[model samples]
Target: MGLRTDPVIFSVSVALTVLFVGASIVFTAPVDALFGTMSAWIITNLGWFYILGVTTFLIFLVWICFSRYGRLRLGRDQDRPEYSRLTWFAMLFAAGIGTILMFWGVAEPISHFANPPQNNVEPQSVPAAQQAMGYTLYHFGLHTWTIFCLPALCFAYFVYRRGLPMRVSSIFHPFLGDRIHGPLGRAIDILAVLGTVFGVAVSLGLGTLQINSGLTALFGVEFSKPVQVLLIAVTTALATTSVALGLDRGIKRLSDLNIALAVGLLLFVLATGSTLYLVRGSIEMVGVYLNWLVPLAFWNDTFGDTGWQGDWTVFYWAWTITWAPFVGIFIARISRGRTIREFVLGVLGLPTAFTLVWFSVFGLSAFDIELNGPGGLVQTVVVEEDIPGALFAFLDNFPFASVVSAVSVLIVIIFFTTSADSAALVVDMLSSRTQEGTTPVRQRVFWAVTSGVVAATLITATGRSGLDALSEVVTVIGLPFFAMGFLMMVALLRSLNDDTVPEAVHHLPTLRVHLPRRRMPRIPRIPRPADGEPAPGSPRWIIPRPGGPGTERPGPERDHSE
Candidate 1:
C-alpha cells in the first residue's frame, strides 16, 4: 500500500518543523540566545520537579510489581507472548539505552571524577571514583528507565488489553474519556510528535558529532558542520532504507547486530585493559550506587551548592522524559501478550542490569587509566573541553586503538540509525489515524529525513550552544508531559482493576469457587423455595458458600413461621 497518513498530524508536524528550522537558520543568533535563556530558566526554577518526577516514576513501577494488579495480562489472558524472553530483552535493552550509553559510558564517569558533585570528595581520588559511578548509575539506572517504563506499561495495557488505539492520549482515557478524540487529545499527540522529533534530532546531532570526532581521531578527518551534515544525510538514508524494510526485517536485525557488536567491543576492552580492576570496580560501585541512590534521588541542591545536580541529573530527567513517548510507544508496540509483572520486571530490571555491566566495563576502564595508567583523559575532557574525543582517547591506551575506535564509530552510527528509524515509525504512528498496521514508507522516510535535517540545521545554526539550548527546550516541553505520566499510572491501575483477565482463576485463587453440592432426597420436581428460604427438605444439607459461611446453619434453622 501507499504511505497513508493523518492529514492534521502530518500537516501540523511538518509546518512546525519547517517554521522552526527556517527561523533557526535565518535568525541563528537570536534563536540561540533565546533557547539559552529558556534552558537556564527551566533549570533554575523547575529542576526539583524533574528530579522528583523521575523518582516517582521508579517508585510507582516498583509498587506495581507488588500490587495485586501485577498478575494482569497486557493482552487477553489466553494470549501467549509474541517473542521469547531473550528476544524481548534484547529489543528492550537495545532500544531503551540507544547511543547515549556509547556517548557517555566512558566520558560520564571521567567527567564526574574530574568534577565531583560534592567538594567533600577530592577530585580524581578513590572517593571521587566511587561517587562518579554512583552518579552515572543514577542517571542511567532504574530511575531513568522508569520514565520509559511508565508510559510503556500504560500504552501496552490500554492498547493490548483494553482494545484502545495506541496513542499518547489513549492512556488518558480514564481521565479524559471520549474527550481523547477531541482537541485536547490532538494537543497531547502533537506535543508527543514534537517531543519525539526534536528529542531524536538532538540525539542524532550529538551522535553525529561524536562519530565525527571518532573519525578525526582515527583517520584525521577535519570536523566541520558540512561533514557532520553529510554524515547525517548518509546515515539517515540508511535509516530510511531500514524504515522501508519494516521493523522485523530492518530494526530488529540491526538491534540484534548492534547488541553483538556492543558485546564484542566490551569484551575486547575487558580482555586487553585491566580486567580485574574493571570487575572489582563494578562490584564496589554497585554497592556504592545502592547506598547513595535514595539520598541522591531526593536531593535538589536546596540547602547545598549542588548546581551540578541540575546540570546533570535534571538535564538527564528532561532528556529521558522528552524521549519517553518515542521509546515508550515503541516498547509498547513490540511488547504484546506479556503480563504486567513480566513487563515491569523486564522493562525495569533487565535493561538496568545490562547498563550497570556496560558502564562498569567502559566506565572503569577510563577510571583505571586516569588513576593508575598515564592520566590525560580528565585534562582532555575538563581542561581542553573536547567531550567527543573522550572515548577514542581512552581507547588509545590499549593495543589496536584504531581498529577498536573504528568499531566504536560503527556501533555509534548503528545506534543512531536504529534510534532514528524507530523514532520515525513512532512518529508515523502518532500522526496516523489508524494504529493497527505498519506506517507507510513515504511517511517513515519523511520523518526520517526531517529528523536528520533538524539535527543538522540545529547543529549548523548554533553549534554545541544550540544543542544545549535544545536540551533545555525539551526539558521545558517535558514537564507538562511528565504530569501526564502520573495520570497514566493511575489509568493503568484503574484499567487493571476494571478489565477482566482470562486466566483469573489461575493467578487469583480467590476467584476459584469451591461450593459443595447438596444431595436432595431423590425428590423429583419439588417446589423450589422462595427467596431467602432453604430448598424444601434440603435445609440440613445446604452447602456453605465459598466466600464466607452460609446464612443458615447446616444442621438446622428456625423458620419465621415458628
Candidate 2:
C-alpha cells in the first residue's frame, strides 16, 4: 500500500522546516541573534511560568496515580502489557533520556560544585558539593520525567482507550470532538511536528558535538563544524537503516542494547571509582534531593537576581517540554495496556532512579578527583568551557581510559541513532492520515533525513554558536507545548470522570459479606438494556453502535492478557 500521509500536516511541516533551514543558512547571524534575544526575554519574563507549571504537573501526576483513576488501564480492561517489564523500562529509558544523561551526568555536577547556584555556599566547598548534587537531581529527577509523563498519559488514554488516531491533536478530542480533524487540529499537529523536528535536531546537534569531542580526544580529529556535520550525516544514515527495520526489530533491540551497555558502564565506574565514597555520597544525595525538592521546585531566583535559575532550571524545563511531543508519543505507543499508576510510577520512578545513580557515580568520582585526588575537571569544564569533553577527561583519571572512553563514544553513537530513528517513527505517525500499520519506509526515511539536515544546517550555519542558538530556539518553541500541557491535564481529567467501568471488570469475582441471621430488606436491581443499546443511565459512548459517537473501530489488539 502507498503511504497514508496527511497532506496538510506533512506538506506544511516540511515546507516550513525547509524554509527555516534555508533562512538560517542564508541569514545565520541574524537568526542566531534573534533566537538569543527571544530566549533571554523568555527567561526574564516567563521563567516563573515554567517553574510553577512543571511543579503543578508533578503534583497532578502524583494525585492521578493514587486517585481512583490509578486503576484505569490505558487500553481495554482485558488488555495487558505488550512488552515485558524489563523491555518496557529499557525502551522508555533509552528513548527518553539516555543520550542526555550521558552528556550531562558528569559535566553538570562538576559545574555546579565549582559554582553553586546559590551565593550562600562557598564555591568548591563541602556545602557547594551538597548543593551541586541537590540541584543536579532537581533538574533530572521527578520534574523532568513528569513533563514526559503528562503528554504520554494523555496520548495513550485517548488513542488506545478512546480509539483515536495517535496524534497530539487527539488528546484534545474531548474539547474539540470531531474538530480534531479540522484546521485547528491540523495546526496543533503541525506545531507538534515543528517542535519534534527542532527538539530532535538540537539533541542530534549535541550528540554530534560530543561525538566530535570524543574523536578529538581519541584520534586528534579537528573539532569543527564541518567534522560535526559529517558525523551527523553518518549517524543519520544508521538511524535511517534502523527506521526501516521498524520498532520491534530496530528501536526495541537498540534500546535493549543501550540499557545493557549503560549498566555495564555504570558497574565499571562503580567498581573502578571510589566505591565506598560513591555509595555514601549517593545516599546523601537522595536525602538532600528529598529535603529540598519542594523549595527547589518553586525557587525561580526571584529575589536572588542571579539569573542562574533561568539559565539552568528554566532552560532544562523548556528543553524537556520541547521534547514532550516526540518523547510523549513514542512513550504512549509503547505504553499500551499499562495502568495509569504503573505508567506514572514507571515513567517517573525507574529512569529517574537510574539517573540518580548514574550522576552520583560520575559526579562523585569527578568530585573525588577534584577534592581529594588530582584536580582537572574544574579547569576543563568550568574554566575552559569544554562541556562535551568533560566525560572523557573524567575517564582519563581511571584505569584503561581509552577503552572506557571508546565505550562511552560508542554509547553516544547508539543513543544518537536510537533517538533519531524513534523520532522519525513518531513524526511519521503524527503526520500520517492512517494509524493502522507500520508507516511507509520512504516516509520514515524522509523524516530521518530531514532531522539530519536540520541538525547539520544548524551546525554549518553558526558552528559552536549553533548549539547555543538551538538551545534558545528550543526554549522558545517549548512555550506553546508547555501551555498545551495544562489543557491536556484538564481534558484528561474531564474524560476520566465521565468514563464507565469496563463490563469485564464489573463481572469479576467480589468478596462476600457475612451477616447475622436477621431480616434484611431486599434492594431492587437496575434494569439491563437491549442488545446494541447502552445500559440505563450509562454513558452512550461506552458501546460501539451504528451512527454513534463510538462508531470508530477499536485499536489493534497487542494485548496478551488472559
Candidate 3:
C-alpha cells in the first residue's frame, strides 16, 4: 500500500498522538459545563430562527440551481462525469451516513415513540403518533441539509472561481477578496482547523466507544478502557498511514467499505424487523415530508408545545451548519466536474431521499420493538448507561440477536474508519493550498498531524468532554460566519438574475439563467385640462417633455455641474 512508507503522514500521525496526550491536562470539566449550558440555551431559544433562515435560503438556492442555472457546471462542462454514478453516490453516502445515523436511525424513534419528550409543561403528555413521523422527518429532512448547503455553495464558488486554497476562509472570498492570505485569513483558517479537528476527533472517539460495545456484545471481547483506547489508536494509526498513501487507495477503500457495511446492516434490519412497517413508514414519512413541508420547514414554536418543531427542527439545522465547513469542502473536492445543478441536487436533495428511507427502515424497526416486543428498549434508552447498551437493549428483542450484533460491529468499525480516512483528506485540503496552483505537502502533513493531536488531547482531557464542548463551540463559531456566507450567496444569486451581466458572476460556467425579453410596461401621460379645453395656463404643476427642462432628467448643463 506504500502507506507506512509515507514519512510525512506517518510523522504527523505520531506527533498528533504525543501532543494530544499532553494537551489533556488542560481539558477541564468546567469547560464542558460551560459549553453544555451554552448549547442548551441556543437550542432552546435561538434554534428555530436558525432553522427557518437556513431552510428558506436553501429552497431559494435549489430554485436558482435548477430554474436559473440548470445548464451551470463547475470544473468545465465535459462528457465524462466527475465520478462514476456509483462512486459519486457512494461518496455522498459515506460523507453523511456515519456512526450516529447507524445507531440513532433505530434508537431515536423508539425513544421518541415511547416517552416522547414533554412537549409542554403538562405533566404526562406525549407527542402524538403522527407528530412522531413529522418529528423524524423534521430532524432528518430539509433543514438539516439547508444548513449544510451554505458551505457547499461557498466552497464551490471559492474553490472553482477564486483560485484560493481549500480552507474555510476561502468561503469568504467573494467578500474578503485579496485579504485571504492576511491576518484575518489566518484567524478564519485557525478556527476552521480547530472545529474540523474537534469534529473528526469526536467521531473517532465515539466510534471507538461503539466499537468496544459492539465487540463485547458480538464477540465477547471485554478489553479494559485503556486497552480499548489502544485498539482505537492503533486502528487510527494504521488508517492514517494508509491515508499517507494518498486518496486513491486508503480513503477510497475505507469509504467503499463504509457504504457496503451500512447497506448490509440496513438490509439485515429490514429482513429481520417488520419489513411491512418499514415500507409503510418510508411511504408515510415521505408523504408527510412533502405535505407539511413548508410549515415544518419554517416552524419555530415561540411556544415549545410542539416537540416536533423545537427539538428536531432547530437542532438538526444547527448541527448540520456546524459540520458544513469540513463536509462542504470534502464535497467540493469530489465535485469538480459536476454541474452546479447536479452538485446541488446530489448533495442536497438526493441525500435527503436516502435518509428518509434509511431512517424509516431503522425507525420503524425500533417502533416495531416497542409495539410488539418484550424489551423496554423504547422506554429505557435515555437511562441506559451508554449508546451501545441502549441500542443493544433494542436488538436483544430481534429474531437473531447475534447476527444483528455482528452487523452492528461491522457498521461501527467501517463507519469510523471511513470517517478517519475522509477526515485525513479534508485536513489535507485545508492545509495544502498555498499561494497559487500548487498545494503544499508540508501543509497537508501539518493539518493531518494537527487533527490527530486534537483527537488525542480530547480523549485525555475529560475524555469525551472535549468533544462535547467542541461541538457547541463549533455551533457558536458557525452562526455569524453563516450570516456573511448567506450574504455572499445572495449576491451571487442576484447576479444570476440580471441577463446583461456576465455569467461568471454566479460561479456557473455558462449564461444559462437568461430569460427571453418581454415587452416593457405602459405608462400614462398627464392631461392638460381637457384635449379641447384651453390649456390650463401653464399650471404650476406643468411637467416637461422627455427632452425638456421639466423632465426627470435634468439639462446637460445641470448634469455637468452635479
Candidate 4:
C-alpha cells in the first residue's frame, strides 16, 4: 500500500537520472550536439512512417464506418452509471488530450498559414487559411478517434463480461485468451507503462522549456537549457505529487482547471488579436477537412513532394499514431458503459471540432503578427522561436502580457499533470485484475513517480529523442494488438443474442410432465382468420394460413368436430 510495496519504476528512474547526470559530465560538447541533431534527423527520416501509418488508419476508418460491424456494441450491459454531461466533457477534453494539443493549438495553424500546403491556396488568403483549419479538423476527426474507441470498447467488455484484468494488453483477449497472464502480457504492460511515462513527463519538459524561452524573450531572464530541465522536473514533480493524492481530488480538479485555461487561451487570442482572420480560417479549415477527409485518409502520396509531406503532415500523423496506445487506454478507462457508436463519435468527432477551434483562433493571431502586426512577430518569433516559446511570445504581444504568460504557464503545468496522472491511473487499472479506483492509492504513487523518472532518463539520454524512440516502440507493439481487438469485437457481435446464463434466471418455464402423447410435427402451424375474411396484417408473414395442424390448406374437408 505504501511506496515500499512497489519500487520497480521508482528505482529505475533514480538509477537512470544518476547515470544520465554522470554521463553528461565527461561527454564532449560536440557529442551532446550530435544527440540533439540526431533527434531532428529521426523526426525527418521517420516522418513518412507517420503519414503512411495514419493514412492507412484513416482509410480503414472509412471502411469500418461503412461496414456492417461499424455500429457494433460489446457485451450486454443495458444498465450502467452514466456520467453527467458536464463531467464527461471535462474529463475527456482535459485528461484525454495530450500536451501536444496545447502546444500545437496555436502554433500548428500558424505554421500552415505561413506556408500553406502546396495544394492549398496562397497563405493568408481567406480561402486558403480557412481551408487549412479543415485540415486540422480532418486529421483529428474520425481518422484519429476510431483507434481510440476500439480499445476502449475492448476494455469495457472484457473487464465486465469476462472478468479479465484491465491492462493495455487486455485488448488481445481474443487471441491470447488465458495467455494474457503470461510473459507476453507483462511485456505489453511494461511498454504501455513506459510509453505513457515518457509521453506525459516530456510534456512537462516542453512546457518548462517554452516557459524559460518565453520569459527570457519577454522578461529578459537567463533561459539556460539545464535550468529549463530542472524547472520541468520540479514542476512536474509537484503535479505528480498532487496526482498521488488520487483522481477524485487531484487529477479531476486539475483537469477542470486545464480546460478552463485552454478555453481562456483561445478566447483571449481571438478577442484581443484578429477575430475576423480567426473566424475566416476556422470556416476554411472545416471545408478543407471535410472535402479532403476521405482522400487524405488513404492517399499514399509517396511521390508527391515527400519532403514537405515528411515534415508537416507526416510528422503530425506519426505523432498521433504513436500516441494511440496511451490515449487508447486512457480513453478506455473513462469510456465504460459507452456504446461502440457513441465511443467512436465522441472520441473522434468532438476532439476534431475542438482542434479546429484551437488552431483557427490561435493560428489567425499568428497571421496578424506575420502579416499586419509587428515586423518579425510571425516569422521571427514563430519560425525563429522554438516550439512552445512561439505561442508564449504571441501571447506576450497581446493586451495583457503578464496575464497571458501566467495563464499559459498554469495551463502547461496542469495539462501535463492531468495527462500524467490519468495515464498512471489507467496503467494501474490495466496492471491488475481490479477496476480503476480500486487500486491502492499508494500503488498509484509508485507508478506516477516511476513514469516521471523514465521521462527524465529519456530526456537525459537523447534529449527529446527518448520520446520518439518510446513512440516508435508503442506504435509497432500496438499494431497486432489492434488487429486482435478487431477480431474480438466481431466475434462478440455474433454471440450477442445467445445467453450463457442459467435458464431459471432467463425465464425458461418448468414442466413436470408431458401431456398425453399427442404427436405433432416438430414445427408449429400458422393460424388463419375466418374463411371469407382477409388476413389481419396482409403480406406481413410468410407462413401460409392453416386449416389443421401443420397443414397449409384444409386436409380433404375435415369434419366440423374433427
lDDT of each: 0.85, 0.91, 0.63, 0.60
Error of 2 at 142 (Å): 0.4
Runs of candidate 2 with Cα error greater than 4 angstroms are 500-562
Leading candidate by lDDT: 2
For every candidate in turn, the CA RMSD to the true structure comes to 11.1, 17.6, 12.5, 10.9
lDDT of 4 at 363: 64
Candidate 2 local distance difference test against the native: 0.91
State which candidate, 1 or 3, has the greater lDDT.
1
1-562: candidate 1 lDDT, tens digit per residue: 4557767767888888788788877887787678768777888888888888888888888988878888888788898888778777767666777588998988899999999988888999988988888889989998989999999999898888778877898999998999988888888888899999999988988898899999999888989988898999988998999888998898888888998899899899989988888788778777887998998889987877668877888888878888999999999888888888889999988888888988989888888888789989998888988888888988899999899999999999999999999899889899887775375678888889989989988888877766776776787788788778777778877777666455665466555679999997885776777887877777556566776776654766768896
Better of 2 and 4 by TM-score: 2
Locate the minimum summed-lDDT window of 10 residues in model 1: 500-509
Q: Which ranges in model 1 have alpha carbons more than 4 Å from their true place?
A: 1-3, 500-562
On TM-score, who's better, 2 or 3?
2
lDDT of 4: 0.60
> Candidate 2 at residue 434, lDDT?
69
Compute the lDDT of residue 295 as modeled in candidate 4: 64
- All candidates' TM-scores? 0.88, 0.88, 0.78, 0.74
Model 3: residue 454 alpha-carbon error in angstroms:
2.9
Better of 1 and 2 by TM-score: 2
Ranking by lDDT: 2, 1, 3, 4
lDDT of 3: 0.63
